[model samples]
Target: MVAADGGTDRASALVTSAKFSEAAQRHNFEAGWLVRDPWRASTVSDHFRRLVANRLFVAL
Candidate 1:
Protein backbone atom coordinates (compact mmCIF):
# COMPACT_ATOMS: atom_id res chain seq x y z
CA MET A 1 0.00 0.00 0.00
CA VAL A 2 1.80 3.07 -1.25
CA ALA A 3 0.42 6.60 -1.63
CA ALA A 4 1.94 9.74 -3.11
CA ASP A 5 0.68 13.18 -4.07
CA GLY A 6 2.17 16.38 -5.46
CA GLY A 7 0.75 19.60 -6.92
CA THR A 8 -2.96 20.40 -7.43
CA ASP A 9 -5.92 18.16 -8.44
CA ARG A 10 -5.13 15.79 -5.60
CA ALA A 11 -8.61 15.26 -4.17
CA SER A 12 -10.24 13.67 -7.24
CA ALA A 13 -7.23 11.37 -7.41
CA LEU A 14 -7.47 10.42 -3.75
CA VAL A 15 -10.80 8.67 -4.16
CA THR A 16 -9.37 5.92 -6.33
CA SER A 17 -5.92 5.88 -4.74
CA ALA A 18 -7.37 5.51 -1.25
CA LYS A 19 -8.57 1.99 -2.04
CA PHE A 20 -5.07 0.78 -2.90
CA SER A 21 -3.61 2.20 0.34
CA GLU A 22 -5.97 0.78 2.94
CA ALA A 23 -7.63 4.11 3.70
CA ALA A 24 -9.77 2.77 6.56
CA GLN A 25 -7.05 1.59 8.97
CA ARG A 26 -4.09 3.73 7.95
CA HIS A 27 -2.73 6.90 9.48
CA ASN A 28 -2.77 10.28 7.76
CA PHE A 29 0.03 12.85 7.59
CA GLU A 30 0.56 16.32 6.20
CA ALA A 31 3.77 17.72 4.77
CA GLY A 32 4.76 20.76 2.71
CA TRP A 33 7.67 21.92 0.60
CA LEU A 34 9.38 25.30 0.86
CA VAL A 35 9.23 27.60 -2.15
CA ARG A 36 10.42 31.14 -2.88
CA ASP A 37 9.39 33.48 -5.67
CA PRO A 38 11.91 35.18 -7.97
CA TRP A 39 11.37 38.56 -6.28
CA ARG A 40 12.27 37.15 -2.87
CA ALA A 41 15.17 34.98 -3.98
CA SER A 42 17.93 37.56 -3.70
CA THR A 43 16.79 38.79 -0.31
CA VAL A 44 16.36 35.27 1.01
CA SER A 45 19.72 34.18 -0.35
CA ASP A 46 21.50 37.17 1.22
CA HIS A 47 19.84 36.55 4.59
CA PHE A 48 20.67 32.85 4.47
CA ARG A 49 24.30 33.55 3.56
CA ARG A 50 24.71 35.91 6.53
CA LEU A 51 22.96 33.49 8.87
CA VAL A 52 25.30 30.65 7.90
CA ALA A 53 28.37 32.85 8.16
CA ASN A 54 27.33 34.08 11.63
CA ARG A 55 26.76 30.51 12.78
CA LEU A 56 30.08 29.33 11.40
CA PHE A 57 32.26 32.27 12.56
CA VAL A 58 31.09 33.96 15.73
CA ALA A 59 31.83 37.71 15.93
CA LEU A 60 34.04 38.98 18.72
Candidate 2:
Protein backbone atom coordinates (compact mmCIF):
# COMPACT_ATOMS: atom_id res chain seq x y z
CA MET A 1 0.00 0.00 0.00
CA VAL A 2 2.80 2.39 -0.75
CA ALA A 3 1.85 4.21 -3.99
CA ALA A 4 1.38 3.85 -7.75
CA ASP A 5 -0.49 0.59 -6.98
CA GLY A 6 -1.98 -1.17 -3.96
CA GLY A 7 -2.93 -4.77 -4.69
CA THR A 8 -1.45 -8.11 -5.62
CA ASP A 9 2.04 -7.56 -7.10
CA ARG A 10 1.71 -3.85 -6.23
CA ALA A 11 5.31 -3.66 -5.11
CA SER A 12 6.37 -4.15 -8.72
CA ALA A 13 5.79 -0.47 -9.54
CA LEU A 14 7.32 0.79 -6.29
CA VAL A 15 10.97 1.45 -5.61
CA THR A 16 11.80 1.11 -1.91
CA SER A 17 9.84 -0.28 1.00
CA ALA A 18 10.16 3.16 2.66
CA LYS A 19 12.41 1.69 5.33
CA PHE A 20 15.54 3.75 6.12
CA SER A 21 18.62 3.19 8.22
CA GLU A 22 19.27 4.88 11.57
CA ALA A 23 21.80 7.32 10.16
CA ALA A 24 19.55 8.15 7.25
CA GLN A 25 16.69 8.76 9.64
CA ARG A 26 18.83 11.11 11.70
CA HIS A 27 20.08 13.05 8.71
CA ASN A 28 16.60 13.31 7.30
CA PHE A 29 15.19 14.63 10.54
CA GLU A 30 17.99 17.17 10.97
CA ALA A 31 17.78 18.38 7.39
CA GLY A 32 14.00 18.50 7.59
CA TRP A 33 14.20 20.65 10.73
CA LEU A 34 16.59 23.00 8.99
CA VAL A 35 14.41 23.32 5.92
CA ARG A 36 11.21 23.49 7.94
CA ASP A 37 12.32 25.91 10.68
CA PRO A 38 15.85 27.21 10.27
CA TRP A 39 15.35 29.67 13.08
CA ARG A 40 14.55 26.84 15.47
CA ALA A 41 17.19 24.44 14.21
CA SER A 42 19.35 24.94 17.28
CA THR A 43 16.52 24.12 19.63
CA VAL A 44 15.50 21.15 17.56
CA SER A 45 19.10 20.03 17.30
CA ASP A 46 19.42 20.03 21.07
CA HIS A 47 16.24 18.00 21.32
CA PHE A 48 17.46 15.45 18.85
CA ARG A 49 20.83 15.35 20.55
CA ARG A 50 19.14 14.44 23.77
CA LEU A 51 17.09 11.83 21.99
CA VAL A 52 20.19 10.30 20.49
CA ALA A 53 22.04 10.41 23.77
CA ASN A 54 19.14 8.68 25.45
CA ARG A 55 19.05 6.08 22.68
CA LEU A 56 15.52 7.05 21.80
CA PHE A 57 15.90 8.01 18.15
CA VAL A 58 18.99 6.56 16.47
CA ALA A 59 21.39 4.06 18.01
CA LEU A 60 24.33 5.89 16.46
Compare the candidates by lDDT and give the number of the best one.
2
lDDT per residue as tens, model 2, 1-60 = 112222323222212334378876766543211122333443445566687799887843
CA-RMSD of model 1: 13.9
How do the predictions measure up, each by TM-score?
A: 0.31, 0.34
Q: Candidate 1 residues 1-60, lDDT tens each? A: 111232223311111223335564377443433333333444444554576688963434
lDDT of 2 at 7: 31
For model 1 the TM-score comes to: 0.31
- The candidate 2 region of ten consecutive residues with least summed lDDT is 1-10
Tell me the deviation in Å of residue 46 in model 2. Answer: 0.6
lDDT of 1 at 35: 32
